[model samples]
Target: MIGDKPAPPVKKTRARRPKVKTGCKTCKLRGVKCDEAKPICRRCISTGRTCDGYGIWGGGGNAYGSVSRITNSSRSPSSLPLTTITTTTITTSTCTPGPLTSTRTLPPLLGATTQHEHRAFEYFFHRTSRKLPGIFDSPFWSTLVFQASACDPAVLHALIALGAVDLGKATRELACAAERVRGYERVALVQYNKAIVSLGVHFRRGGGDARRVALITCMLFICIELLRERFKTAKTHLGNGLKLLGEMRRGEGGRKRGGELVVNTELESVDDYLVEAFTRFNIHSSLFGQDNILLYTIAPHPSCADHAIPRAFTTFRIARLYLDTLINAIYNLAHQVASLSPASPIPKHYTNTQSHLRSSLDQWLKAFQTSLPTLTTHHPLIAPLVTPLLHTYYTMSTITLSTSLSPRDELIYDSHTAAFESMISLMRGVFETILSAHAPLGDEIPDPPGFTADMGFIPPLFFVVLKCRDRVVRREALELLDGAPHREGLWDGIMAGGVGRRVVEIEEGGSWGDEKGQGEVVVPG
Candidate 1:
């Protein structure tokens, strides 16, 4: 037994070391060793794996990723690469309530062309979603809207159409050539038609959530038309959306026999996300003199004396929302007061409201300044994304308030010349940041003259040139406006500058020659 069976001691086996957790996230996730690169790892790029990025807290995306899931598989090829719209050029769609939802796998559409539809979806995810939220962070564009898009063909097509318009930014030049048609415009029109048909089909079906789908589609329609620069069509879409919302509200308000709300919860006005979007569109539009009914009443922000305002804004978005509320209140108050006769004294209530709004603005500025140092720390892209824009908005809001009662008086703006000068500085810094941060993904991906669905720098810049009589400041504003062609909602920098330059010429009794920017801004045919 000892002779043959003194089994050579079983070969000793070395213990297995914990799997090496090195390299980029995608590589680490694949259980392969990583090269451990900064920002993005080369290993992932080499293998065509999205870097999924690198961070100390976790992998790519924010701390609060979206809970919503897009269960259907995408009809498009999975191999197509996603490009990032630079931090400065693209903004918002967040950590989901998520901008650009975490649900990467899109639900399939029954009749979508694999390549065409997929590219549109990708553009919206990477570009349009971010631009839609404007200065404030909104989950409507990033999360709920995507969810709705995934579920509804109408919404999907509408977004695809929008993506097409946004993608055509650079195509404007080609489009304006009399011999050629706008390539992207053709695509957008096709997709838009499809969306209308699809939405019609939904309406005919009349499902329990038909109204919900309608509201979502209507929002998409507004966005689609707005970005396409068809203000009349967008206005029509908004009117329809508002009408649908009004119907829902009236039904809720005029309920039946019992005290309980007889209206279907799904049909009882649009959900918070939908209503918020619609309300924002209405408010922004009406502030510029559009005849719109305010869907939801804005509760007046408590006066600073009434003990409102946080010690310091916890997030830039929160601060933005507070400022926007005040801006809307100021605009709304100004709107109501503008109707009064020039000889008449401002009403006591209106004066009180103005006083409160002014106080709130002061308090907001104080809080914003306190949090300025830490603002960039809120999100990785926060600095390029919102910092300059917020500063620009604050300056404009201050100007807006001081001239509230004097909307017709060009003379009043002279007092705000310093503020206008500051705006030019802010804009110069912004344009520099935009140029530095914006990296278009080669020639195939057209970077249209900077276009955003949100109201951005254009409105403020146009306002500066229109009201400020200081020729030097006005010219500076015009030059800056003309320098970069961007569309921030209805305010197209090129058109605004061209028209503003003409007005200046007439008012100054002089001619301005050769004032267009690097790219010829051809008006959309």
Candidate 2:
């Protein structure tokens, strides 16, 4: 084994031919490519968009890919995913997807419409919202479920930003959510059913959109009534009936429309109504206290201590109570703020009450602002979760006004006023944000009346008495007022609204349903 000098040139084996680098713009843009002998080629992608070679990019889409750029020159970003171009360079940590661009503009209300038309309108609107980029726009459960169904990193982060969900008020949000979803008719009942089931779980768990339930319930009812007027026919009637039935059932275990579940729960049952009303009554009553709770507070009085929340109030009743409190609280607070008498010494009770309530209000508002994604993503269903925040804000506003006047220290009062101003700004933002999101559907939903001094929840006849204002609002107000039993000062702070001549016209020789200067009724202006 003599190694001859330079062992006869051991030939180096030629390196395997380098695999042809098939240039793929799309793959390169996505930072990945196809697994083929050709590696990546033109047939693999057209117009610089990833073809996935096959439709592998089918059911589950590109999970964590960059924003999808439109290849078609004719189709503008406005028509597709990218709506507004970021001409102003935004230097940030990284670019993130935004809410989807909506294609369909708000439809003009056609006086009224048929059931089929209504469904079509809604579908079209939904499709428009779909085009908007973001997890909320996706059909898969949560935006975070992409590739893997783990909680969205974005969502989890958002939750932290928003603060923890209010465990104390979770049940209330869930109950109201169930009611909000019990409407819409389906082309395929099964699809609706499935939607409700999935939706119900979120709603029941108080996972999202629990606050806007009452407002939506009212909006939907108004929509349906208007639809009835547009198309008067047996089929239309049947469609309307089925839709209402679906709403009552809440899309659980129902027929399929276009392969989606259709929920057809009935909203008209005595039991359903009672449940809805009880939810509001209990919450409001607990906040206001024992003797004041009305209709469905659920607590047993001495005579009916054994009984639970009554099961007879309709969805209408529950909706009414929430709406009444919301409007009244806001108007009252606003008046209180505007009517700051410069001369009076600030009351201690008012200051303390404001401080306590303000903290709670701030906590609630901050939480809701953070939860917008979950609520917006789960619209028409989860949207109600935001409703309670509305009430909370109004309540806080009331406290802010009271506190502003309470602090005896001049410097403290100025500070309180500044804080109160900030709060008012936030409330206005909440209101505008909510209104802007849902293109003004039909007429602007009217502001519900505050409680009248009589304890009867009546819309003041002022709108009716005055000639120039909206008749529909006037009529609705009057109808609500018919239910009130006048109680003194009961509505003093609630209904002295700035709309017109004091809404409560004093009944000569009588107090509002109370003996003049006696009974619970407050004297009318």
Candidate 3:
């Protein structure tokens, strides 16, 4: 039976190919041809390796596995491989002109950073003029020659205008030309001097420009530095500078301007520009100081104008007149406060020392009243000086008030109070008159220098008067009605009301009131 079992029919076994799927992960990663299959692709199994399912498929780990699997896909199906693709085509812009236009060369001397070296290569302006008599010939031609030849007024004006900034550099030569000694050469020299001096006139009318002003200012101080005789000439230039600044301010409205003079745009009224210019001038003029040696010595006195050549007197002289007026006003205020001699005795008609103080006040007022018209006309800048002057008065008053007599004496207190009030009243009246006289008429320009000084001078004066009775006499001056400190309140009030600029225009016939004139106090003389 076992031998018969051996005769069982022999069985046949056949090899089956692996089935393919839609896409292979290895093919996707390597971007090569692959047969898509299920569990294991035919290509993977054919390599005699264990079939790891498509490595790039979602079921796999990160790209590392896929990248490793991609090696199997690199076997080429054809001799011409995909790597043979080359020779790219490119299009360029047509607008570029040429290499010369594109390339720029830097000189060996040129700086790699800030452009310092090319300074020598920069263009220069060389000036030439006729050699005038008695002075070394100027390398720069005078601007005046154009005007004298009756050349284009605009061109001459432009030259004169531009000349201001450079005036300092050329002032010595200008002064030399001005002082030319030969009588025969006088005509040309005179014309040249006129041209130089004309810069000032143009400056007054908003012509001599910024560069000229700077030069003139420099020359002014330089004259102080070098030639004593030239100081007057320098002063003249400076005065013209100041005057021109003032004119621009008045013309530009009330605003002040600075830097290179600019055209008045419609949006920014000329008057406003003028105001701004004037303000800058005020600040600048202050630097000259009340007593700069250059200004004081070189500045012409008012009487200097009487000379045959009135033009020779510098505008500084005019400015000095203003200064003199200020000094006089200060002196008078100080004298008024200090020279408060007691009355002889109580009169039957008058009550006490208060009455005598009033009489003295009236006398002061009368004198000031008589001079009011002339003061406003000549010293129109007085208003702006008031604050400093008032502050000065207050200081003087404090000293006088402190040293005068026993605080316990009612008569002493009364007399002091009366005197202070009367002085204050007189000052107020003076201010009122000033306002009336100088108020700008329709389309009329205020005298800019005077207006500047007046506008600037009032606020401090106002404060000096505000709490006088309390601050000096009353012990509780520090405490105000508000729980806040008195000083704080005063400052707050001033700030809320434009600080220094409030009360610019006093009401007509009312010292400190609105146009309707209510709440106005008639200051008792």
Candidate 4:
């Protein structure tokens, strides 16, 4: 009957719909129609499935396709699997139809992310840079340190470590929590260790850049140790820096015994800046323990001897040079006198050397006077206390020299007394200046960017308290020390002040004189 029905009427068959050529991975895998959407497809979102992103169809068609189809092509020949994407090409439904391609890449350092490094750099430039007193105002801080940090990982780490330390010191009080401070300390220590390890590697490798960075790192280590109050470590780092500098200078000529050619490198302006910093540090360190050998290594500039003075003495550089020379002479003479027998007459050479040094000192004084600024033409940049401080230093140096000649010589003793009086006067002037300006006293003042007690009126004041015999002047010096609570470089103002006061008590109580010798004064470093 069914075969007979076909003869009765010819029935038309229905045509099938065309299959979808393009869709997202989830829709294609599910064998469903894809409502193509950017980023995530609507079909996948509605059906609670993940969209596998969009790609151009590998087959010849103007429709979007799943990533698997485009990536698994025979022509593409990708090392990755069909499921793995090496590069992603994202397309939109807009008429302008080129795919946007993107590839992921890793950063440079494993733990040090770019964003974190940038924050550290910003901290260094704005804050840590200001903590170096003499160097901060120069390009050494603003330019050289930045340039060096960008290229050298050791320097970068050291810089960030310093910034952490500074931040800790600044915020420790506000935080009032040891844990917070400890957190910063841990960060600083880790970074410092990294710098040290990296620097050691560079040193072992040995290159011009290595040597330069080694010297810089050493200097920075010294600064870090000083900030931490680790004097012995600071000194060790300074010694290492000096050694590196010597090697750099020596490597500039000739050849080694193995016939290797020596690298002849010219120093940059930044190197000169570093040398100057080292020179100043060397002199300061010598004052602590009579380590005067640094003086021999760093000869005074020839220009220092020139009698003519410029119209204005705006900076402390020139004066410090002359003062350093005199200090060296004083220590040398003191060593010679110390070795002499108690009953022995002053040696002829000793007298000659003293005379020569005294004459040179006189000339330096004259030059200093000529270079000094007039009241009407004072440099706006130069602090008012600077001139008085210089005067006190000059007077102290003279007294130090005279005292070194013979502790018992009546002429020298009288000269020392007179000079002591002059120093007290200069110190009073400094005190007056601070008062007139309505500025806080040393202890009352907030710590400045690069503040150290020795940088202010404390060092010279302490010297007077330790060395001067006058009760009134010594008492005034002690008072000044009491008013200053800062630590300077390696010198702890508070501790030194305490020891000085104790020494004064012992001397005045006659206990020291009774135990040691009459008129003997023990000056603490």
For model 3, state the Cα shift of residue 76 in Å. 99
User: lDDT of candidate 1 vs native?
Assistant: 0.61
Residue-level lDDT of model 3, residues 258-287, one tens digit each, is 322222222122222232223222322322
Candidate that beats the other on lDDT, 1 or 4, i.e. the better one: 1
lDDT of 4 at 128: 57
**TM-score, candidate number 3:** 0.21
Best-to-worst order by TM-score is 1, 4, 2, 3
Q: lDDT per prediction?
A: 0.61, 0.29, 0.28, 0.55
When superposed on Cα atoms, how far off is each prediction in RMSD?
A: 12.4, 20.9, 35.7, 21.7
Report the lDDT tens digits of candidate 1 across residue range 1-525.
556666577788976545756665566657777776433355655664545443321123321122121111111123322222221122223222122322233444434354444556566776677666754556467455654554467777787778766666534445344322255566678888988898788789764367667887788878777775788888888878877766664555533222111221121122445555666676667644576655343221313223256668777766765665666667766777788899888778877777776787788789988998887665545466477777887888888877887757878878888998898888878777767766664554456566555667777778787777888888888888867677766667778787677777777775453443233344432
For each candidate in turn, the TM-score is 0.69, 0.23, 0.21, 0.64
Q: Which ten residues in a row have the lowest lDDT in candidate 3?
A: 119-128
Model 4 — TM-score against the truth? Answer: 0.64
Clashing pairs in 4: none
- State which candidate has the highest TM-score: 1
- Model 4 over residues 30-69: C-alpha lDDT tens digits? 6678876533366765654545534211111111122212
- What does the lDDT come to for candidate 4? 0.55
Error of 4 at 15 (Å): 75
Ranking by lDDT: 1, 4, 2, 3
List runs of model 3 lying over 4 Å from the truth.
1-212, 215-420, 430-457, 463-525
